[model samples]
Target: MRSFTGWTCLSNPSTNHLASLASAWLLWAMMATSLLAQPPLHVDGRRGPYHDHGRHGGPSGEFDLVEPTGAVTGRISLRRDQLIYRHGDGRQVVYRRNGRYDTPDGQFLGYYNTLLARVLKFPRSGFGHFLYADLDDFTPFPQASYRLLHPVGAGPIGGPIVGPWAGGYMTHDISVYGGGLGLPWLAPAPAFGWGMNAGPLGPMPFAPFPLNPLPLSPIPLNPGPVPIDTRRVALPDLPPAKIRFTNSSQRDVNVTLSDARQAGLSKTFRLGPAETHDMKLRRDAGHEWVETYELLSPDGQWITREVRHSIQPQPRYEIVVHEWRVQSVAIDRTARGNNRIEDINMQGKGIGRFLLPPGPELTDQTIDVFQSARAMQNQGTVTPLISDEQIQEQFRPSDRVSPFERALLQQQRAIQQAQQGQR
Candidate 1:
């Protein structure tokens, strides 16, 4: 016998390439012969080849021999029960069940479901039955494109491989069902079928191979425009009007008036943490006048105490004139430190006072008037004014009056005129 290795070595390079091509052709021919030699995998429940078809098999003895007029092609190793089809592209046309074939390279394409059924026709060149028979809209079979053999079966002849696409598989163990397929696999009977049919694998039915798998043809992502931020800042209400007061020591302090009107005034005075101070507010004008007393620190850093009062008219019919007087003002410093008033006391006449009903009951008219006046006072809280004394104290004989001061004085005169006209 000739040595096979020596024969291979002695072959010419061109001859070797031709011989290899010839051998490949021979192998393909043999494969085709083998496929043709085997009887069609019986659909009538037979266990082997050469079995008789059931009476239901159409035209039992008449075998249809489809001739290939073009290139033969097909996917290998698909599921055993899927429906299959062949589609033609371009100028090519598949061999219909009617037994006609046409092609131009892009003509015939094979498609299969899970039951190994031939639902679609291909060119006679395309052989091999699809492994699958059912093509449900849902329930995608990842490996349905081709049949792959299971290694443990009876060599290569037993059957095509039937495993999950990645590494996933159907199982019976409860733990496996819970840990692997999630809760759906553990569900009972018909429910499991429903769940499986309703899952992600159910909806998609398309060609298994991606048309373009390279990263260069990536899916596009779109990001829309960003939103704008709109916000606002708010300010607190204006501070209350300042009231000047003089105590028995002749020291002056400025008090913040909380509410001041003809009826009464309410003020908040902060002594030290634990100190107390006496506050007096008397009217030197009409009976409806009221005042609030506020004490200030020497450095004007703090407000010591706040006092509020309603000045009632003395019962005298004879030109009842009232005067706002500071009987005596004292600071209670026992709680923390010595208390002192920093500013000069303000003494003014014509502060209005009102007569109260003999009984504690308040009249509606009195309440309405008082409320209106209180509203006016609140409005004046933010208005700036200079006292005559302050003007005199700050004025120098050689200095001329400022335009702003002159304007302010004119405004003051106009206000006085308006008040006199209203009276």
Candidate 2:
């Protein structure tokens, strides 16, 4: 029988075998080319199908895949007719019933109006005074204003037939303000007595009062003036702080500081338009740092605004080495199922075979390595001495195998010794 070793020689009797070997070599070359054609790995650890990088694009110029958090800024206004009301009892209320109108830009804005009325009450006595008081009662009143007897019990001998009359009065002047009611100075009470409850003058059957209408003396209508638009006025802006980072740890850093409330700083205070502020920052030993800015408006509104930066450390690399020995092997004879071949070559220094789907192949070989430096390099986990030219150029005579590789080699030697003893 011919020995398998040194079998490359092609003689006339073995030409067929030589042809078969050449065909196998060609198939392997094709498979290697296909594997090499796959695209590069991405930051997210995916192998790409190859995409276009625009003309102006570079690796460093790619948009950040992560979305950033941010803020929005704008303005808002209050409507008119929303009355600010103060009652006689000193209670304050806001009336909001008046409808809003559309702005030139089709936006709905607010509005206001003023209304007035007079409240009257008959005195307890038929002879008491019809006293009038302004908002400030202490102020002097114009003289010669006629005084009428309090309508209470002022008929039939002394009072109207309306039985002892409860307090009562009349008002003809009234108006509305900001969807609320208002009252100006009360008019002088007339001298003629409309007998209480005497039909119209008493009980119920009486015509409305015929008080002499003096030449419509126009009491100048005075509605309180609307407040000035203070929103447009510009407020003072804050100065920016000079910020600096002590550590060169990150590509960007962010720092934030709020003003002390005791410093008369209001929460609404913000950096003015077209203004920039600087802030200083110190490094925290052995920790990362981020800086941020919080802008505020003068009136304490939080004007949405922010600026961010980060600081990061330098890049680094490490070399690793490893070795291994064969433990045991078993020959597989069955060839009808998926169990064709997993591996063949043992004690190799590189990645080995990866199986494909099941097929009917009687003569196939697969190689697998349990601990190979080349496998690590192919996976991009560790730098290999032969292919990592940059690392090789930077190598020093004192640097040797890494600790992990040393341990692996030690284990491999022990396994080899044990195998020899078993033999």
What TM-score does each of the candidates earn? 0.13, 0.14
Off by over 4 Å in 2: 1-214, 218-232, 248-423
Residue-level lDDT of model 1, residues 343-419, one tens digit each, is: 22223222223332321122122122222223343432232222355533433312233355345445655654565
TM-score of 2: 0.14
lDDT: worst 10-residue window of model 1:
1-10
Q: Write the per-residue lDDT of candidate 2 for residues 22-100, one digit (tens) a residue.
A: 5345434433221221111122433211122123211111111111121111111111223233333455434332222
Computed on alpha carbons, the lDDT of every model, listed in order, comes to: 0.24, 0.24
Clash number for each model: 58, 64
Alpha-carbon shift of residue 110 in model 2 (angstroms): 19
